[model samples]
Target: MRADRLVSLVLLLRQRGRLSAATLAHELEVSTRTVLRDIEALSAAGVPVYAERGRHGGFALLPGFRTELTGLNHDEALSLLVAGLGRGEQVFGLGSALASAMRKVVDALPEGSQATASDAARRMLIEPETDLLARRAAVDEVPGDVAAEVRRAVFAGHKLRLHYAAAGRPPAWRTVDPIGLVTVRDRGYLLATRSGEDRTYRLSRVLAAEELPEPAERPDHVDLDRIWRDRSTRFRAGGDQVAVELRLRPSRREELAGTALAVLAEAAEADGVGGAGGADGADGADGAGGWLRMTVTFQDARHAEWALWQLATDAEALAPPSLRTALRDRALALAARYDTPP
Candidate 1:
């Protein structure tokens, strides 16, 4: 913990330019005397640390001086290098620049530390899940330069002219006042105001984006949280609330606790017949046979259908006759599509 604190202090000084001993002690949650002693140790280890006294008294490193990883004890250096590399291909651009940077950091490490770093690197390996990798690759294909420019314009309160394409629609050119960038899972979206109305455009669907010359006055207030909340509410309005009863297995019961829609009303032992459950008066001694009654409000029948599909044969919906009818209709429609003569 002390070593980590020392590293943090050095990094903080490097970022902030300088700090008085009292300030450093407060920031590091240590005594001023201890801070001074740590500074002495850093200087003794040839860290180029120095102190200034009087009215503007403080400790600082010479300008442009960075702590060399050579001072880290093996494990520390290796962990640092690996963590930097794990940021994916976005950082150092595609090519040998990243590899070269990693090599330099590793090569600068002390001999003993170098061996330890190598051992640590060998022991730690990160494997990207296949589905997640695919999603990331899709995001990576987006023009990074364009995204950066859009982000800058959003922060600077600049209007943007861009060619955009929405799902199942032809590309169209539009002018919008950029508001903010929102990242969800693996995709990025730009929230903007167009024709006095707010909209969200997926970054991947943006063909081209450039700042407009006519700078618009920044709004006095930008309520991003409210905008997002309203958007979500609108999306959920597609379907109405319908009661759903589920007979969840022990594992599925735990999983339901985390789901956004599942609301538990009652819990009892699962009935022997996996699909059917006894009403009100049921014994709890049916082995793993217990039923959990839940009320899930679906925005639309499609939402209920999808939820049912995900839960598979483990769960069932028990109310709102319209919901079951909609599910059956959808199933039959899909069956017809698959059953059609080729």
Candidate 2:
């Protein structure tokens, strides 16, 4: 217990520089006498900790004392740095702050560790195939600064007054109690409650956000994961759930296995064809060696249109005459536009 307390006291001193006895006692959930004893133990262990007496007195570390992380070996340091870089700028925010902070940490590493970390960074790269429509849609969705502020407010349980651009309308300013920030693929969304109604606002569509004096109360037992899972069903109105079958090539089947849609059903091999089931399995098949069949619920033909665009030529929709016709027409329109000479 003493060892644990000593470690925690060191961390607190490093993070906050100093702590009054009462503050330390509150944080450690111990009596002030115990906190005083822990401070004495830290000093005895040559931790360079001390306390001053008077109105402004508190426990503190001696100036220039450092907590050297000498325990981490070369491989450990490299692994951590490589992982941090792969998270991209959105997770860590833009600018050089993250990079700068990383540089300082790397610089403090043992000589060989820095080289290993640098090599690991050079060998690692993340590149996702570009989708122009999706990219444009994401860009038009939220600005980075507004998204960052919304994230901060969400975590701090603060209310925000946002000037937001609603779909097909002029921007309107409204007060929203920020609930959570959801990063769906490349898009950022804020799940909030306005006028007692739950709503999702695209961060890019926000023109401005101001902090409110009153902090919003977060709902108890709200499952964000479940909310996201039912997003399509929740957003759309009065559309028949259609079953569409798809025959994905073996390679594509492997790719789909890693996607969220794959969890809904199992893929089986039948007659030299892979048969994967989905929620709304519409019947159809092809001669492709590694193809799979799966069904997805579409609220309406319009929703199916969007799904078709995302699946592209990798999969096909083979049911609900309306959805099939919409996909065909859209493909034809795109072909015609491309065929026209510039």
Candidate 3:
């Protein structure tokens, strides 16, 4: 581990010259004392490292001294740099490795391309943690040791024992044959099998993990993408999805679709909200024209109610009498709660 840390230290200095000991300590997630010791270690090992003493002084390598790992074209290097700007590396405890690898990638590029690649990466932002609405996405936190053990079992083809806490269930231990690890939108999942039945466990829910000595019972070759797709399809079809017809402003259609499980149908208001509302005393229009009718599916009645509620008066659920009732009840309760000013 120290060796890796030392290599990382050198790479960081090579990538960002004249970084202060405090800066190095922050980057290395260590202490300034440790950084000083590492610098001493590098110097003792014949590395051409030198220090400057002043308010603006820090450690820097000698001119023309850089690690060589060349052989990447401009576009190729740019793509790598841009791809590395995402949070994918945070999954499975690979953040440190990803940082080190990116440093190496920058070092590998020709001098002329190094700045260009970094600039290109800065211009392209991917999967930001928050959206345009300022709503932050939830980040699932997985334990370092658990992720490492799970990754090892998955790669080494060893059986994995996981102390898992599934939704609505107590924590329990399970022995599974790890097939592979998958990361989507910064969330990690372990694809595995228990008693030959497919199982997918969210890494964040793994309280602990252990790699068993026995080899996993998995095929030598696997189409992980296809397997994940099939499992996702089955999961979507298995839930008790509730279908509801909604009359909403066209602008809010995307927002509704995002929360719903599926958009079964979409159509313009043929007669400008005339007869669009069903007979549960439904008043589809709040006097705003250009409403769109959609049949969307949600995981359950409660899910549909909650999603439509978020749109407030902009969207109105037209069908499933129960959903309208739930929304009305929620609106009344909310109004009553706010009836008294703070």
Candidate 4:
């Protein structure tokens, strides 16, 4: 790792011509003392690095010095940089290293291609840093040290001890064999198994983590993609799997479909469609307001109630007494609250 950091320091010097020790320390995520030590090390190793004292002056390599780094062609360099154009790297606790690598990749390009590629990259937007709906999306805050421990356990094929906080349950320590780490929309997850049973934990929810020295109990070869898919399938089906029938204005179809966990059946027959909203899957809706009838599956009754509540008067729950009653109770509560004389 020190060697890699040394190389990165040299690359930074080569790329920017000159950078202050403080700047180098910030970029390398190291102390200024470490930067001074590395400078001395590089100079002793026959690297023509020198320092100058001034407000603008800092460390610099000999003029016309360029390390023959990895040879990445123009498009290859651009593609690599574009792939990491988001905060996805932060989820895995590699943002600083990734940024250094990206710079190195760009600097490795042919001088003519470097500027062109950079300009093109500036024009392209991947997961813009700011969210339009909110005051920028709130970052999923996972402890850096814990994420490092989780990654080490996963990559080293070791078991891990986790202090996890599960919703509606007390925080407890758990021992799990980590399978892989995944990050989606900036949220990180550790997919593992406990006693051969699948377990997944949100990295943000981990209160503490420790990598166990003992070898993990896991398969010889791991197909993380396949493993994640299988786990996701089981997780989606493991819940209450509540089914509901709904009639909604044609315009609200996208909103309803997007909110429901899954759509069991959907049809728009002329004015309306047939429906089934019970355990036996039998339902009926007589064309109302040219509405479309849909039988959709929710994670549970609570999920269905929450979603239909958003649709308000625009959508109607047609069957499944549980869902209808929940919505009715919610409506009554809202009415009572608003009707009470303040």
* TM-score of each prediction: 0.51, 0.54, 0.85, 0.77
Residue-level lDDT tens digits of model 2 in 1-342 = 455455556656654667899988876657999998888777887899988888988999887676653233332333355344433345323322333344445556665686788688679655433454554323234555675576567767888889988889999999988877565554567788887777788777788887777888668557888876676456643345444555444545554444323234445446534222242233234434445655555545565567666767666666666666778788899999999798
Model number with the top lDDT: 3
Runs with alpha carbons beyond 4 Å of true place in candidate 2: 1-88, 91-95, 127-144, 219-227, 230-233, 236-287, 290-294, 306-317, 327-342
lDDT of 4 by residue, 156-250 (tens): 89999999999889999999998887766677889889998889899989999999999999888888788888877887788778888887667
Q: Which of 1 and 2 is the better model by TM-score? A: 2
Model 4 scores worst on lDDT over the 10 consecutive residues at: 278-287
Those runs of model 4 whose alpha carbons end farther than 4 Å from true positions after fitting are: 17-22, 31-62, 69-87, 269-290, 321-342
On lDDT, who's better, 1 or 3?
3
Please give the range of 10 consecutive residues that has the lowest summed lDDT in model 2: 274-283
Number of colliding residue pairs in model 2:
10
lDDT of each: 0.63, 0.62, 0.81, 0.79
Residue 104, candidate 2: Cα error in Å is 2.4
Off by over 4 Å in 3: 69-86, 272-289
Which of the predicted structures, 2 or 4, would earn the higher lDDT when compared with the native? 4
lDDT of 3 by residue, 165-274 (tens): 99999999999999987777778889999999999999999999999999999999999999999898888677788999888777788888889888899988776344
Report the Cα RMSD per candidate: 15.4, 14.3, 4.2, 6.1
